[model samples]
Target: MPFMIGRAPVRRTLKYLESGKIVLKDQIKIFSINYNVGQGFKNKVHEGAQAFVFWTLPQLQYKNPDVQIVTFKNMTPSPFIRCYYEDGKQILIDIDSRSNDEIVNHLIKVIGKSKQVLKAEALAAEEKDNPANFGVGCARKCMCEIPGQIPCPGVCPLPKVMRGKYFYFKKDELENPEL
Candidate 1:
């Protein structure tokens, strides 16, 4: 079962947005800015991914206008969501869960308006704000998997999964999925 994302996290994230304290990224669509310092850390992988699509995605595309679509490793479809079962025991059907078809739709909706250009400095800033670095420990934590020491999600109150194993984004496929 996918873990639930509680309201407290959502409230905190909304508060940040209303207060204009968010980083205002323009690249990453289907997600929000509060996912960084909000209670997102407390959210589970499924919830976090859902948050990306449900909450963060629109805000980024509309507000930031600078967000880009890059890929990382372990973005999903791994230890948690692997082969499907008919009984629906281990199936993950979150918003961020994307297949080639959905990805294509997402691209048509979000990526079609390609006026913003990617700059080196902007890339660096995006890199700086990446979940693997100052944000959450998706990719880095995966690389630093210490067996029992799950990396603490920066501000959201969630604990990292697989401790040392990093969660990454499949760059090319990010915008290719549909909702």
Candidate 2:
């Protein structure tokens, strides 16, 4: 009942959920990164990989929940990123001696969704969010269209007492009093 301003944790969490709904291309099923923790010069060769993983891992995991991402430290001689596709094909990109930005740019160029695809997806999401749209893809669609589903409050107004606006009236006020 108290009004508040500034950053709300609940709003941030919901925004995170909304922003991370992007699904990776259907072919990409697994993503794996192998690197060594910074140590001696030989191992240090993969410092980029270490930095890249730290920065991008969380975003990748959240953005593409369907894709399994696995990381291995001190497991390989050199740092590399491997993407496994549903067709059993895999792409290996060496990240040794590259900067974090370079690694990210290279990966995006090779494996990220195309700009056109992203635009189409964004458009579809907009359409789905439109209040005037209904049925299968629209979020505002009436649930009653589905078998056995009851109509929602928007489709069939709830009884007065069950509605939020009802509380604004005086206790003794009639629902339909003469003007």
Candidate 3:
């Protein structure tokens, strides 16, 4: 049976396979930036750090115009930046006690990464194997053969007539049937 996808908004992001292809697949649109830092202390080093981030913002924006920066202040005791890629992967770096140069270097390295890392490999198809053999043991049929029916424990399941019925036909009757 084919899987049916719902029409709800929450279920829209889910991927569905239909007719040997993917449907409603998720796509990476843009990269995002989120920064959450402490509120206290207005020292020169802090200002320089902020200036460094601001300076790097345009460089990232130039590379990806759709990139956005979100500020969340006083949320934590330390400072950290989170880079969320379109492939659902994220890179989080702690900069609570780092210098301006170190922070800039980290940001540059992250920005240099290609978007190819975000996408995962395609899913492969499953092989169909014969259920009876299934590479378990010998591939020969059962030796116990019954007339007008399959052998006991054959490669396939026996029908209802072979399972419960005791009516058996002779060799000549089986060769020339008039029913």
Best by lDDT: 2
TM-score-better candidate, 2 vs 3: 2
How well is each residue in 1-179 modelled by candidate 1, as lDDT tens digits?
A: 12226653543354544532233223333321121122333334334444444444443344445544232334444212121223433222233434434532443344333334335645777666454352254455353354455444663345334334324555455556772
Q: What stretches of model 3 exceed 4 Å from their correct place?
A: 1-48, 114-179
lDDT of 3 at 67: 58
Per-residue accuracy of model 2 over 56-81 as CA lDDT, tens digit each: 56567777879999999888998898
Most accurate candidate by TM-score: 2
Write the residue-wise lDDT of candidate 3 on 51-117 in tens digits. Answer: 5455444444443445555665545545667766677777676765667667766654554433343
TM-score of each: 0.20, 0.62, 0.36
- Rank by lDDT, highest first: 2, 3, 1
Each prediction's Cα RMSD? 28.5, 8.8, 15.1
Please count the clashing residue pairs in each candidate, in the order shown: 37, 0, 0
lDDT for position 63 in model 3: 39
Q: Candidate 3: global Cα-lDDT?
A: 0.46
Cα miss at 173, model 3 (Å)? 99
